[model samples]
Target: MTETDVVVIGGGATGVGVARDLAMRGVDVVLCERGGLGAGTTGRSHGLLHSGARYATADPEGAAECIRESRVLRDIAGEAVERTGGLFVQLPDDDPAAFDARIEACRDVGVPTETLSADAARETEPELASDVRRAFRVPDGVIYPSRLVAATAESARQHGADVRPNAPVTDIVVTEGTVTAVETDAERIEADHVVNAGGAWAGRIAELAGVEVPMAPTMGVMVAVDVGGVDSVVNRCRPPDDGDIVVPHVDRVVLGTTSTPVEDPEEFSTDEAAVEAMLSEGAAMVPAVADADVVDVYWGVRPLYAGDDGGRGRDASRGFQVHDHDVARLTTVTGGKLTTYRLMAEAVSDAVCERLGVTEPCRTADAELPAGDAEKLDALVEEFDAAGPADTDIVG
Candidate 1:
């Protein structure tokens, strides 16, 4: 039986972030994932690095956190983040009074936002529709979730952390009301501490440990376009609707998303209706997007841990919750956005270390992650490019 100081469930950003932090602190750590890293909600995100402008009006606290973490992530995870900035545009039907309130709220939270004339906005982004009434530019950007998660795992491994893919934790073994081990398909591993960063599966994992987590999973769908038609991240200056945002990645622009309630997180699918709605709504912001070709459609489920059936996922607090089940010797971290994943990990690692009597402070924030080096990244990208397209021909 293998043994470890900490066993992290889930391989998403939060899980890998915790693993890296603990391992860097000289504590034995192991991370197990049901599938590939970032295979869940992490990779399916909108890729926006919030400048805190989005939540400035709805939730000031959340907006402040986003701005603080956005800067930190930009510095540490340079390769994973692109400083494209962002713009909140007011369309013909949008209320100018609401836009004024949002700008004031952003200023209150110390977020730098500048109002621009419609022509100025169009000058910056040629694809933007001339019908735009007003625009506010903020310090928003883009992030590659897969790269971030991979970098975290690689950093943990470099510090002697063990990472196992396809290792779905089937059961949590507790004796005398204390967690002692976890069972997977292949074998059982003893764990002194367990951190459930399972994203959407967090509530289920907590239930296995005889605890309850109030996660209300909500499904969101995004469509990737082959062309990069926009210069920066464009958002509708009001409440989140079908496809009020267009996020630009390296070679393409992602039009997203739609929020709807779902019974099962794993079974949700992106259909034609969702795609059509995204295109229609997104077209209102940039009329050129109406003719863009969609490359792929994907869906993600946010683990919003508040309210009942008709809950508002985006409206729920973006802050995270860390539950320490002393009896079960386990901790479950839920909620929070992708922008603040590192902070979330630091909190979870600190709690785990305290529970296990490890006095090492978290070094994840300071320590440069594995892929922080540019040379290593170039090599990996070159290798992937050299592999070329896979051969589909196979003999049975």
Candidate 2:
């Protein structure tokens, strides 16, 4: 039997982050995961460290938060991030009105942007389509999810947290309207409070404690091609849709994605046509990708918190939500982007700490996260089997 002040379910970036935060604040925390750390959504992201330009039009506040967090990640995890700035390019077929709106919204939200002429844009990225209408440079960058997750988990372990991988939480024991313990396959963990950080499976985790987390999971695909010379993250300057967002890696570029709603996150079908569409769409911005060989492809499900009106797919909020269950000590945090995982953890920890009578403030934002050379970081990822499909080419 194991006992702790907090039992955090899900070992992704947010889950480990919660554990690390609470543990640093002197809370006994244990993190349990069904598979390896980041084996879920965190491990399968397109690796864009957003500068918030993508959501500045529709979501200014969220965009602001992204820009703030993006800078913070660069400070804390410099070795894990590639400082490749992002560019939102307008193609010949893209809406001219939308381009104007995007630039205005980003400026209004205090997101630094520089609109570049076609010639200048081509100079920044020579492989850009010769017919490129225009481009906006933003602070977008790439984050290696596997290294980030492994680094955070290592921080949690160093902070005296019981970070357990391969620990499937079978059930959450809520007795008499109070969460008393969490039941896993190996042992029973008696926890003062339980946090459901299960990402897309958050609804299922809540169900175990007799709560409803309205998660409308949306599945998307990412295709990585063996192309080079794309020195920055590239996005289509239009409304959110399929086959946009090109994330550059050291050796290849990852092109994605399609947003289709799904009933079950675990069981969903992928479209091969989506991959072909991504290559075609990607070539619109960077012509070199048109004939590039695909190095990897992976599917990811977004943990969308569907409210009453049921905003589906891209319409669903990319913001995080904290759900307090009928049970006294059960909390579930879901949604939000990989760029803002630290902020999400802070919010989750604040709520849990408030209920637990802990007054310690969050120190994750400014704290220097510990990381090492490539070999050591790779070892951490291997230790947890957390080489996410999208990070396969980078981690090990």
Best by lDDT: 2
Query: Per-residue lDDT tens digits of candidate 1, residues 206-253?
Result: 877778777777888787775565779999988667798898765567
lDDT of each: 0.80, 0.90
Model 1, C-alpha of 68: deviation from truth (Å):
0.8
| TM-score of model number 1 | 0.92
Candidate maximizing TM-score: 2
Off by over 4 Å in 2: none
For each candidate in turn, the TM-score is 0.92, 0.98
Tens digits of lDDT, candidate 2, 174-270:
8999999999999999999999999999999999998899998999899999998889999999998888899988779999888899999989888
Clashing pairs in 2: none
Count clashes in each candidate, considering only residues at least 3 apart in sequence or on different chains.
Answer: 0, 0
